[model samples]
Structure formats: structure tokens, C-alpha cells
Target: MRVGLYPGTFDPITIGHIDIIRRATALVDRLVIGVAINRDKGPMFSLEERVAMLEAEIAPLQQETGVEIVAHPFENLLIDCAHDVGAGLIIRGLRAVADFEYEYQMVGMNRALDSSVETVFLMADLKHQAIASKLVKEIARLGGDVSKFVTPAVCDALYKRLGR
Candidate 1:
């Protein structure tokens, strides 16, 4: 089976993320959404919280696409996570050229780490192209309505986390 790994912080999964996950399902037999804890950035939700939210948000989509979706929490390198999940490909979502340079370097490093794992980039849908987790959290933190960016559950979680 062609298994793909889509790893991200997913502090809160946004519609853009949903778009990528939905699109990626068509390419792989099983897609594992690896939610890694990025110690570099302070996230709004805990790892457990993020995993629960991801599972909740993806449940319906899993039924719709018929592609097995699993959320995993990883603390080590991304390549290791891919290996653990038996992923032959690493799926990444690209929003614009600005995201290219960074992701390009990441692909190179990931390749160097594991030559067996190939990287695939999927452009975000136009409607969600501008949405980002950081921006979504920022907007929500400042009391801006982010209902359109994230799901209702995530929106409520964000507000609750921010003590709004």
C-alpha cells in the first residue's frame, strides 16, 4: 500500500490543512497525519488536545474519502516519524512562493536523512491559500472571528484556550 505522511504542528488544524489532507487521500492508500510537537513555537493547544481535535475534525472526512486517517504524536525527527509509519512519501502543502524556499530546504534535509522517503508538495486550494495556523491563532487570540478558517470545534477550542 502507498502510505503517505503529512506532518505538521497542527496547533489547530485549519481548513487549509483539511484541504491538503482531503487532496492527499486520493494519492495514498493510508495517510498518517503526524502532529509533531515543535518546541520552537509555543502552541495554543497541547499535543493531546491537538490530537483529539484533529481526530474529531477528520472523522467525517475519513468516512467521506474512505482513506484511513490516523493522527500520531511524535517527539523525534520527522524522518523517523515517517519511517515509523511506513510512509513512502512525505506530503506537504504549499501556499505560495514564500513557502517554497523553506520547504525546499526541508525536502533536501529530509531526503538526506532518508533517501527512501520522497517528498510531494500540494498547493493549497485558492479559498484556503491565505489561511495559516499561526495567523488563525493570532486572529482568534485577539478576539477576531475565525469561524471561516477553522472548524466549529477548533474555533471553540481556540476561544476556550485563550480564555475568551
Candidate 2:
């Protein structure tokens, strides 16, 4: 089976992420959503919460696309995580040219670590291109409406987390 790993913090799993995950299903039989446990970023949601959010958001997509989707949490290197998930392909979502520069370096480093694994970039839908998790959290924290950027469930979670 063709398995792909899509790694991210997924603090709240924005619509942009959903768009990528939905599109990524077409490329792999099994899509592993790697929820990174990066303590350095000080994410708004815990690893468990992030994983749960991802699971909730992708459930319908999995059903719709008939692609097995699993949420896997990893604190190790992304390349190592891909190996652990048996992913020969690493899927990444690109929002802009700035994202490509960083992803380019990452792809190079990951290739050096494991030449067998390949990285594929999927550009975000134009509507969601500007929707980032960080910005979503910022808007939510400031009492702004985030319904357009996230699912109703995620929006509710963000508000509940922020005590709004």
C-alpha cells in the first residue's frame, strides 16, 4: 500500500489543513497525519488534544475518500517519523513562496537522512491559503470570529480553550 506522512503541529487543525488532507488522500492509500510534539513551539493545544482534533476533522474526509487516515504523534525527527509510519512519501502543504523556501531546506535535509523517502508539496486552496493555525489562534484569542478558517467543532474548541 502507498502510505504518506503529513507532519505538522496541528494545534487546532485549520481549514487549510483540512483542504490539504482532503487532497492528499488521492495520492496515498493510507494517509498518516503526523502530529508533531514540538515543545519548542509551545503549542496552544496539547499533543493529545491536537491528535483528537485531527482525528475529528479528518473522520469525514476518510469516509468520503475511502482512504485510511490515522493520527500519529511523534516527538522525534520528521524523517524518522515517516519511517516509523512506513511512509515512502511525505506530503506537505504549501501556502506561499515563503513556505516553499523553508520546505525546500527541509526536503533537502530529509532526503539526506533517507534517500528512499520523497516529499510532495500540495498548494493550499486559494481561500485557505491565508488561513494559518497561528493566525487562527491569534484571531480567536482576540475574540474574533474564526468560523471561516476552522470547522465549527474546532472553533468551539478554540473558544473553550481560550475561555471565550
Best by TM-score: 2
Candidate 1: residue 49 Cα off by (Å):
0.3
lDDT of 1: 0.94
CA RMSD of each candidate after superposition: 0.8, 0.6
Give the residue spans of candidate 2 off by over 4 A.
none
What TM-score does model 2 achieve against the real structure?
0.99
User: What's model 1's lDDT at 23?
Assistant: 94
Indicate which candidate wins on lDDT.
Answer: 2
Please, what is the TM-score per model? Answer: 0.97, 0.99
lDDT of 1 by residue, 1-164 (tens): 99999999998999999999999999999999999998788887889999999999889989999999999899888899999999999999999999999999999999999899999999999999999999999898788999999999899899988898
Overall lDDT per candidate, in order of appearance: 0.94, 0.95
Clashing pairs in 2: none
